[model samples]
Target: MPPSTISRVINATNGRDGELVTSQQCIDHIRTQRVNNIGHECISIIRHFQSMTANDKFGLPFAPFTGVNHHRQSTLLGCALLADEQEDTFVWLFKEWLKCMHGIEPDAIITDQDRAMCNAIHSVFPTTRHRYCYWHMQKHIIDHLPTLVSRYGEQFQRYWGLWCNSSSIEQCEGYWVEMKEKFDINEEGDGWLQTVYKCREHWVPCYLKDSFFAGMRSSQRSESINAFFDGYVNSQTQLHEFVTQYKKVVTHRRLSEAHEDFKSLNTKSVMLLGHPIEIQAGEMYTRNMFDVFHTEFKGFGTEFCEELRKDIVEYKVCKFTDRGKWEVVTYE
Candidate 1:
């Protein structure tokens, strides 16, 4: 994996540059490099490049690359920042793979509104699709608009509800204005909402026909794949080991997807919770178990089906049944 190699390079360079190896030593170095005993999370920056086929078969307007070299004309580039202590390292590593192996420029990138990653992207691929993840936006809403989230929980939901759910400009705008007016708090709410709307318009241009750009929305798919490494690879693990484990997971996933099918022979609905249905054969969990839903499908299930259905009215799946279990599904 490019990330595995990248991490090794980083560690080797640091080791050669006389950087500390232990956490305590690093902490001491940071203290010596600063004032007071403030603390901060360690972070790493990695850069990568990718390329996409510029063929016009997909109805794309035109290819961005221009060169006589056949290979150079279809390349795209990317970069990522991994937290030293968090499983988010997979994100950076994945970006590296896109650049080094896929030969496709990452059309879009999504992450929390992290200043470090933002800076890294600016330095690496300034023109790449790098936007703040909607999940993170909702997180901001939760942290910043706690009162609204607690009061008109549904209304608060409407804000993000429009974000990920709305397909057309009118629908998105209408819901945005309604939510803003309902939850007016000094001008902070309005300002935040307006900023979100503008950012959404800039990054999620598929909603507007004039600036329609596909593949710019936040990528929860990558997030889902990376989530598995959360506790498995943390700040304490050596960078080399972390990359090795992540590559094994990535390889297995790719191999599995290669042997997948997307055809549907039939459709069936089953009765859930006293409702009517056709498919059945399983034991219900007798106890409440903490099940972490995949990142993309979080907040979507039978319990919240009604809410989810209302919000995702304009949903669409590119293809069905990509593999035995996992599938590639995208919605707007």
Candidate 2:
């Protein structure tokens, strides 16, 4: 890949009519390429490659404008090369992609704490809930507050646990105050934390407990897609090669998902415990999900009915090596 050739390739791919195809265009291409051999199942698999977007060149301030399908188990949605991370650019890209998908709005979107991206999301999907990536937030803490972790490792761990597990706004506020007092993080010294606290509703789990985030609390899905591309393409990878390599990755992922679906449909998982809930779960959920449900269900035996009222029940949940906790709930 010579410099001149690379420049030409980049220009073509980022140009008005790039070599990269949209989701529908890819499906149509696959159908046309193998019209006689491909079936409806194959077409459905092709549809899973819903979106893909590339960012700007390698050394730009903002990375490429990449988006992935959060709905289809971390599948590549679409990628496009953007001039900048402006609100208008994001709005145009989002609208174009939405039109391709027949204007279906997502329930929730998780991304890094970028003001431009947040503004664009709000403008395009007014009703959709926007969440900050927990992983990114933690990384930011590590990157900026290294001394806090280095000097007070145990305290940092405890604070992080409280912050992540707080169930209510009051609890979150209380824990945050305790954490700040314990660490002596004043407004002047820890401005990042103070700034982040203002937007706690978007990032903190306490406020997002009821939102439908589909278990994605981070941009790990997009990160994973980027990792997949690393093996096939690199900084020097030409635009044409990227398009070809992307299709290959999509094909591999589709095959892997299809195999998993087949196994999930045909196989049954053994129950960890003989609880009625476990039995019901095995019948209702896929094997992978049943495993997760089984682990949570095993803790049920630790909870005992401490008190009972006419319409409310109080359960005493014992934590391993910790004090017993009581929770009051309505009983049907």
Candidate 3:
């Protein structure tokens, strides 16, 4: 906004007032999805504010609040134009968002490891589970541990995968020790590794696997949403231009979703497996969600489940491989 436009925000006649506005239509869309999937254990909130008004977060004004629906689609819950990215600014923004949603707090929220944002979330939403974007941390490791990444490469990545996918906290800890020993990582010199380990509960998978994140593990979905805006807005986009283009972006997403919903409802999905469960899932789930369920069902062909002798409801699910990957799930 120009000096003249910013000056008359309070008393302007031509619809210029506050920096923030939450759309009721977006809230209704999210509320409808919530009512439909009330059984889900986790409903996550994600805030993305990159490459919007300016390159840096402080200069950027747009914060797109998104949530995952039953279809695993990123639904826009609300949006805000912050004056700045200060801790106070973020706190106020989150509080306003909470009010707009009728004080219904989300089960979890995902964001990059920005100190101010983290602090703000902690202050405002104290009980909400907070998780950091692993991809952001991955880039941090690449930048900080370039020598280790370059020397080990794929071997490092394989070990990294094993460590990240640890089945239990103890297993994760054991893998961390093993990784340090195998790679000869210096205990005294690797400050970044130590720092990240202290905050492992926020980003590591095993610590968060039990919590529902709608199967989201990173802010990549936010990146995808930002990608959609590439054609409409760029660095040269002024505040007014951005506001105009944003409506188009939202409209495009709605049209795309409507198209998908139409296909999901009208077409018959061919079942790969002849299981009764597959048929039931196809009927119950959205097209994308059914596809996910079908893929997992296909994985059952590669794995074998063994029931515990003492308990009928307890079983071990595993693939008979040299890698020895397996998991246990209990039914009530």
Candidate 4:
């Protein structure tokens, strides 16, 4: 580690002569004899190292990293150590992962509307398209906008569908304006909308092309992975045990996906569907927040089906309720 030797070792050129007599130069020389300096350091960092985690969130907390595959069927891709709500941690973890991954290319990514995660995505995977889940945005809006239930009733739900599924920017904008007026969205709502609109160019346009993002669009699938180890995580499990169980969960998830793939090989249905669809309570999963309905028969005597083959009207659906049932929400 002598200064002169260190410089010589770091600045060695292919045209330079070999064998050095200096001990320091010999040490530096041997350290990087067959390795690229930066690459060596990066490899060493990942191998004999532990990424730090902070005990910040004292209550029920989300795992550090979670992901669902891009297939429509729910598939857990991978999970990693993550920080609770700290954008810096997400960014740090993401950056570190990029360094570890080196050159592997990713097709698409889905994540919540976390500003830090967005920033990290921009920095590390600039070419990789990042999508914010429509469901996440709607949940955030509902949680923040308390008066939405009384003001617009079911109309609020339509906003998510329109924003996430609309074919054209014009349509999304139309629904945006309608919801803005109907809900009397306050300053907070305006700010939230601005953040949500940031993804318009991606998801909005993709919907127009009939390109549905697979699992990355929703965090629900990620939660399912966490639920596998709920017992250990819920009772303040030790960090080492948590990490070990997490690895097992990942192994189980991968095996499950492989099994699903085997089951799917028998028919084309799996290819068409991409992933195994979870059969949860439809009303619990799809009702209330927003939906699609046909109101064309409002005055058509409900006989429109006779006049038109599936000539059903298409309208966005939503529901908002302030009843005591709010206390039972699975996740706040």
Query: After superposition, which runs of candidate 2 have C-alpha atoms over 4 Å from their true positions?
Result: 1-73, 146-165, 174-190, 304-332
Candidate 1 or 4, higher TM-score?
A: 4
**Could you tell me how far off, in angstroms, the CA of residue 55 lies in candidate 2 after the best superposition?**
16
* Cα-based lDDT for every prediction: 0.45, 0.70, 0.76, 0.54
Q: Candidate 2 lDDT (Cα, whole model)?
A: 0.70
Q: Report RMSD (Å) for each prediction in the order shown.
A: 19.3, 16.8, 18.9, 20.0
Q: Report the number of the highest-lDDT candidate.
A: 3
Could you tally the backbone clashes for each prediction? 16, 15, 0, 7
Spell out the clash pairs found in candidate 3. Answer: none
> Candidate 1 residues 37-123, lDDT tens each?
334322211111111122112221111111111111111222233334233344455456556756555455455665555666555
lDDT of 4 by residue, 53-96 (tens): 24322343554345533223455444565546566776666667
Off by over 4 Å in 1: 1-104, 142-167, 170-191, 194-198, 202-219, 230-247, 261-332
270: Cα error in model 3, Å: 1.1
- Lowest summed-lDDT stretch of 10 residues in model 3? 44-53
Poorest stretch of ten by lDDT in candidate 4: 288-297
